[model samples]
Target: MRPQDSPTRETKRLDGRWHFLADPAGAGRAERWFATPLQARDGVEEMPVPASYNDLTTRPDLRDHIGEVWYQREVRIPRGWAGERILLRLESATHRATVWVGETELGSHEGGYLPFDVDLTDHARAGELVRVSVAVDNRLTWQSIPPGVVEDTDAGPRQRYWHDFFNYAGLHRSVWLHSLPQTRIEDITVLPDLDGDTGLVDYAVEHSGQGSVSVQVLDASGAVVASDDGAAGVIRIAGVHPWEVGEGYQYTLRVTLSSDGEVADVYDQRFGVRTVAIEGAQILLNGEPVYLTGFGMHEDHVARGKGYDDASWKLDFELLDWIGANSLRTSHYPYAEDVMDYADAHGILVIDEAPAVGLNMAIGGGIFGGQGYTTFSPDTANEATRANHAQVLTELYQRDKNRPSVIVWSIANEPESDTDASYDYFAPLFAHMRSLDSRRPVGYVNVMLSPYGKDKLAGLCDLYMLNRYYGWYVDSGDLDNAMLHLRDELGQWAQDGKPILMTEYGADTLAGLHSLDGATWSEEYQQDLLEATHAVFDEVEEFVGEHIWNFADFQTTKGIMRVDGNKKGVFTRDRRPKAAAHRVRERWTRIRGRA
Candidate 1:
């Protein structure tokens, strides 16, 4: 599993310019673009693959578009892949996606954060030119996970969600055409545990056709440390070295599928032998207590929007290393899978989250209005939304269950958990998540409502992950009041007898603005707010962690309240440190020394 080693299966990349057309009126279906030849189409524009169509151009209309968008590309199948099973895999397409090859319909997927595949073996032929059409709908409805309403405004229709980030949509990740044998390895699940220095790995291999599976666990030096000859079983390696923060140790599990003595497919699943546990209000890693420190980040940037940017992430890691941070919460949603892999390789702790943001009915009315609003329930009783939420959680679990970097699973972010209906909605989800993976602690990023009101659903989580904007959102510019409020809330939460992580707390600072009196949108105000919160943290014994509100500035729906997106990042959108960054670096460095 080195970068230089080629994959056993052949893959053709389809990640360049594709013919794009905005279908606000839903005319693409009436016109039958899937059945029509590309050459005969009109009004088609070229847009890059793996990019958010919102940020790809200078057109304001396209940037704020909220409807179905059509993308078409022509690809030729390799002759060698004729007899093999062909599949079109998209790393992600926002909201919903319908795919088609020529006149044949391939299937559609609902969720946007996880990968989806369409089997093309029956619809496509080798060495032939095939037209692939993808229809992506970015509109949000009340039934969506991040529930919102489409309202008719002066500017046609506006798409708004309860979340505080821009709804950037398109093919935000890579797409590829993979060719595999008919009897190929579908998936591999590796659950690693530790018995002192020895590593016990419980594994299961899934396949398409009947086969005998053999697994080999290779150590860091490419030495075979353990082996098994069944599709489902466990293997143990003596003298195993556990993975630690900033140490980045990994082992490769090579799963070989053979049908009647003929090699069918070989797959590699990399994992780290580590254990995460919560023992009596302490978060333990490898049986040792560890405190979390980092930011709740987004997959966002100025030019790329929500599209996955490798350079941004590399710079982000460098910044995190400089800030002496060891962990981060994938705030509000699950990031790209490559991010999880990078965290595993670099030894950063992750709180893997789902795209379950905006499950609230109270917010989303332009910032100034939604303040103090009540009844923000995300209709957990709706059977369809609940079913979809469960499926999304299942997919998120299956995708990242083996990554050692992921120690916790965040089921939701700031949902309507203060009401009785909230309990009905979250209890089933909490149970489903627990049943899916028992290795990680499952919780939601509770909002300020949990502390201010009755947290009827707080018992659903193993840990209390709270998000509060006391000074900025409530008593503005009053650090004294903020400290008093934070102390009272933290004291209240500690009484629950659970490890508490102050998952989010920060002020929106316009990068360089200064204020002698500590007013809002000033660097001084942001610094003071955080310092006050940290001061309270020192007094609270149960405060296990504090992740800043944002890793960097990110886009959001246009509003007078947001000065060109949310500007709460310690770092600017260009990945440059603001004044608050220096204070954070200093505080974190001192904390790291004590740690």
Candidate 2:
């Protein structure tokens, strides 16, 4: 079916500012930094919005790094913008940030990989220049993990098992100012069901002024399959085919608003129909078992650093398919909507992560599993931890629920959340997710050893996944040994029997980079590793799925081999193919036909 185009963005803009290193000492130092009166008379320097500190600063010879940066920009609403809902929308800033408009405080937002906004409608005056100041803090504190924290059992920090990806910060996404009439569409949701060949949607429109709202669904032929009068607050769409990974069913959504019986606003979004589940152990895509050759991915390009461009996703996906991967993990954070939609339409599965990474490492002297790390289980969690957990989970679920490629709402990958209560923390959130949409699975990579551990959480999950690094962490390169380890572990679970999925595996590679001994982070090493891992799969009937550690090389703060991130990607960051990429592609694409 033909899909409708998304709404054209607001043409109005206020951008360009100078960034500085922000510290307590600089607190009151930059009032003029955001002073619009100063800017109008040519006070502050000009820099683009949704930019990085490294990109706009004097730090030229750069390495893997994150720190505090200050941004000051000025904007003035013309008297014409009176009564309009004006918002300061920042797609993301690295780490945590606080928004201050002049001396008045606006709001504080956390997570560097998602979009957030603050209402600045009443904060600014007509023809009055308002200063916008931001403190982008990627600093390390008890509650934060700087880009480079990993654990090594041997001695000083050297080796550990963290999903290898770059930790690029700063405002890495688009920033815009939106002006709308009092009544407006606040949020839109669409859920696709391929088996039933139907789609469901719930659009929440909030308004300060009363108006008429309506929703319409159009198919490929530009014919409307559905149109219904919508409440000013909420509207729902039913019996529509949801988006699918490969079948290519689509529909366009057109929401219209009217005041005094005349149209005031319209918004459009195009989407497809698909469903995902963990039926027993294997991942079910549109009701069919899908064994995944998945790759964990990052957004930063090698040269571009924290900056982003649209073309790279296509190149990235091309290399991924060439390597035979069926899934991609936008590791440690949520990705842009375009990238998310592209994956869904092109037959790739996604594990859309929240922007909370290495939270445990920041809390308990730097580690992946600890008792107080995560409040995934809300029942017994401390108020603060649970609050953060609830915040991240809620925002992630609400933002990305429409995409068909998303299968898992991962809470924390390596959070050392060791407690029987950990499961309780997750139970409510997982239940909440099911209440929202019952077709997807919700789980995290195993980290803590709680009373509920693997034994209990296994059954709680529709699909069980592990971030096991036997070869790198345990030094067991033997397949026979690895298989025995996997079997013995699941043999215990065969009693209550939950199907297993290897969400993470594989070693770090330096691509064509070789050692003095002439062996690079070689294909031979990865081949031996995959061979043993496959042996486990061959022997363990309960083991039904696999997603290797990463898709491409990314930036990071920890050391893998002289690099902070594990170069373990089957391909390099620049899209160069490593030997393992071909090997895995042959394994998954043996039966090949494309839409």
Model 1 residue 440 distance off true place after TM-score fit, in angstroms: 0.8
lDDT per residue (tens digit) for residues 41-111 in model 2: 33234545545545344543223233445666666666666776667777667777887788667898866
Best by lDDT: 1
lDDT of 1 by residue, 481-539 (tens): 87888899889889877899988889888987998888899999998899888989889
CA RMSD of all predictions: 2.4, 5.8
**For candidate 1, what is the TM-score?**
0.95
Model 2 lDDT, full chain set: 0.59
- Least well predicted 10-residue stretch by lDDT in candidate 2: 1-10
TM-score of each: 0.95, 0.80
